[model samples]
Target chain A: MAHIQLPEGLPGIRGAMAFRPATARPLNDLVEILLHAPNSLTPAERELIATYVSSENDCYYCQTIHGAVAAASLNGDEALVKQVKHDFHNAAISEKLKTLLVIAGKVQRGGKHVTTEDVTAALAQGATDIEIHDTVLIAAAFCMFNRYVDGLATIQPRDEAMYRERGKWIARDGYVNVSKEYLPAEVAR
Target chain B: MPHIKLPEGFAGISSGFVYRPETAKPMRELAHVLLHEPSTLTPAERELIATYVSTQNDCYFCQTSHASAAAAHLANDWGLVEQVKHNYERAPVSEKLKALLTIAGKVQQGGKHVTSEDVAKAREQGATDLEIHDTVLIAAAFCMFNRYVDGLATWQPEDPEMYAKMGQHLATEGYLAPSIKA
Candidate 1:
């Protein structure tokens, strides 16, 4: 049971966002622009950053749902998503992404954890300025998402199928409308 | 100096947001909604959450900038703001705000650190569901904001006046305005 009276079925951010649609509007907009907007970083790669940060924060719901999204987007490569979490250094992702992940991980631990050498290494790996910026933003954003969901004590369903389904939904349709569809009737207003 | 060649003279997130206005739009809007829009918690209280979380993260840019905003909103109560940041438990804020700050601190350490007992304690202090929700969100969001500013090694001016000016701008016009009012 959630600490608050969030809707029973909706999970993680969905329920928490539903709890306050005003905040949801901008949050979903930010997620949509950050993840789905056309950019050098593929949506799969971006979702992986979000997943990795959530995993570090130990927010089960965020990591699972985003892991599923990364998997669905990567031709259903759930194994690849797991690899990125376990040891992204060994994952099949490119050297550039590996470097980006290093930066993201540092940010996950603490902002000051990232150093000048990390940026130099990432630039050496061919990550553009915006790619590095977005990677940091993506990682930073998930810390908030992770904290918001768990801090609220929203119901975090462990059923694998549920996450897989939500993952496919977000990966396919994206976040803006998905937020609206999932909101409780009164809150949706 | 920012790791990226962001426009110079812009402070902290100002430089980064300019570097990527596409990302900045929603981020600024999110800030407005979370801290500016109508809520059970006062804007000062919300700004305090952001400032306190930044202090915990040791992000000098975020902590100072937001402390200014909190103080500006509270009749330039810089002393009050510092007291809350140093020791919120004994600070002059309402009991409800103290409880919410407890949850915010846990979120800063890491999200899972916040427990159900914390939530119950907050509710006992008369925090509404929305107040609890906003408190966590403010803390969580500041973590992101603090990291975004510091991750790239964005430049932060050392002068307190700069932060006071930025703080006054944010408190007066809110985050929906362009961060660089100068």
Candidate 2:
């Protein structure tokens, strides 16, 4: 049961979002900008960053949702997503992304945990300042998002198929479009 | 010297935003919406939520700045602000607010740490659904903001008065107004 009276059947953050649409608009807008917008980082890579942090935070809903989106963006490579989550250092990703993940990991633990050496390593590996900045923001934002979903104890689907289906929709339409379709009547107001 | 070379004189997160004005636009807009917009929760109460979370994160710049801002909103009652930061349970605030602070404190720690009982407690104390919702958002956003500032190791002022002064300006002018002009 959710901490509040969320609508039935919608999983995870979606339910909580429908319960209060007023706050949902900006939150969804931020996610759209961070994950779907045109940038140096590919949408897959950005979703991977969010997935990685969600994994570290042990947020099941976030990790699954973002992991599925990332996989969809990367040619339906769910195995790659799982591998990266299990251990990105050994995963078959570029030196640049791996180094960026290092910074993201440190941010997950605590912001102060990210060292000057970490930034230097990423820069040396061809990670631009903008990429680095986005990685930190993605990591930081997921921390908040994770807490929001789990804090409310919203219902979360465990079936992998649900994630894949949802991922396809989100990947096809992007966050804003899907969010608009799902906004509860009161929240739409 | 920050992780990135931020503009001089601007303290904490402000300096970091100046370093990358591009990201600052949406971030400032979010703060403006969350903190400055008219709402049932008084600006002071909202600032108190920000201050409490920052203190929990132990971000000196945020805790002090928002603490002063919160105090300014409450007629310069610095003592009251300090009390809320130190121990909201013992602080002289409404029973409803105290219950809400308990929820905010749990959010500062981690979201999953908050239980259904916590929500129930807040409801019992006369908090509306919207108040509870905003409190969670405030706490969650500050976690990101505090980490953003501390992650970069920005310059934080040690002077207590400086924070109080900034707080006064923010309280009087609101986050968007002063942030825009600054």
Candidate 3:
């Protein structure tokens, strides 16, 4: 039961997005350009940053859905996604990603928490300005997004398979101008 | 000084925007739509919500800049803007805005902090679904923007007059192509 009367059977943010498509347009556009746009960061790496931040916020729906997206882009390696979420510092990833995650982690805690040294460290790891910029924005945006989805108590399906299917679809096609049917009235049997 | 090499002479978030126009475009559009677009809520009231949340976050740049904008919309009522930021519960604003501010406060703490009781109170005070929705989004979005500004440690002008001029521009011109050229 969401605070607003969103369209039925549209889980999570989609229902809320449809409730006010005006705001949704810019939000979706930001995600498309920020995450899917051409850049040095791979889709999996970028999705990993979003997932890690959501996990830190304890947003179950965001973590699960974004984790599915990361894994879908990573040849269905769910275990790696789990590892990155739970213990990313020790996970098998590039030092550069680990450093970016550290910066992302600080942004999730609080903006002021990110120190000058953190930026310098990322630069040492060969991260470009846009890479660092997108990392911070992604973490910050997810903070807002996680709050929106949870604040309204949007419908979140407990079943894991649901995210897997949606994950593949989003990874295959970018986030811009997708069919509303992405959130089908009936979950496919 | 910002961690990134933003252009010189621009203060706070504007410099950051100039540095990264790609992200800035959508961000500016979101701010315009949320705060400046025609709505049931007055521009003053909407800017007040942004100011209040930034105040709670202790973001000097966001709070003062938006407070100036709120003041410009409120017939240059800087005193009222200060009251709303420090003690909105007792501020001279309508009951509707106070109710919305409470929800905004809870959002600054965390998303799940907003309880059903909070939403109910705003509705009870004549807030529509659109107002409530916009309130929540405004609060949530400011958190992102404040963090973006502060996270990078963007340079902020210490002079209050600088922000006053900036606010007049924002109140008059809206968020796109802002003239922080001072």
For model 3, the stretches where C-alpha displacement exceeds 4 angstroms are A179-189
By DockQ, the best candidate is: 1
Tens digit of per-residue lDDT, candidate 2, span B20-134: 6656666666676677688888898889989999998888988998998898889889899989999888988888888888888898788888878889899998888778877
lDDT per residue (tens digit) for residues A1-189 in model 3: 777677888888888777777777678778877777887999999999999998998888889988998999999999999999999989999999999999999999888999989999999999987788889889988888888787776888898999999888888876764534543322210
TM-score per prediction, in order, is: 0.96, 0.92, 0.96
Which regions of candidate 2 are displaced past 4 Å? Answer: A184-189, B159-162, B177-182
Tell me how far the alpha carbon of residue B5 in candidate 1 is from the true structure, in angstroms, after superposition: 1.3
Instruction: Report DockQ per prediction, comma-separated.
Output: 0.79, 0.61, 0.72
Off by over 4 Å in 1: A184-189
Q: Give the TM-score of candidate 2.
A: 0.92
lDDT of 1 by residue, B44-158 (tens): 9999999999999899998998999999999998889999999999998988899899999998887778888998999999988778888888898998899998888888889
Q: Lowest lDDT 10-mer window, candidate 1 chain B? A: B173-182
Better of 1 and 2 by DockQ: 1
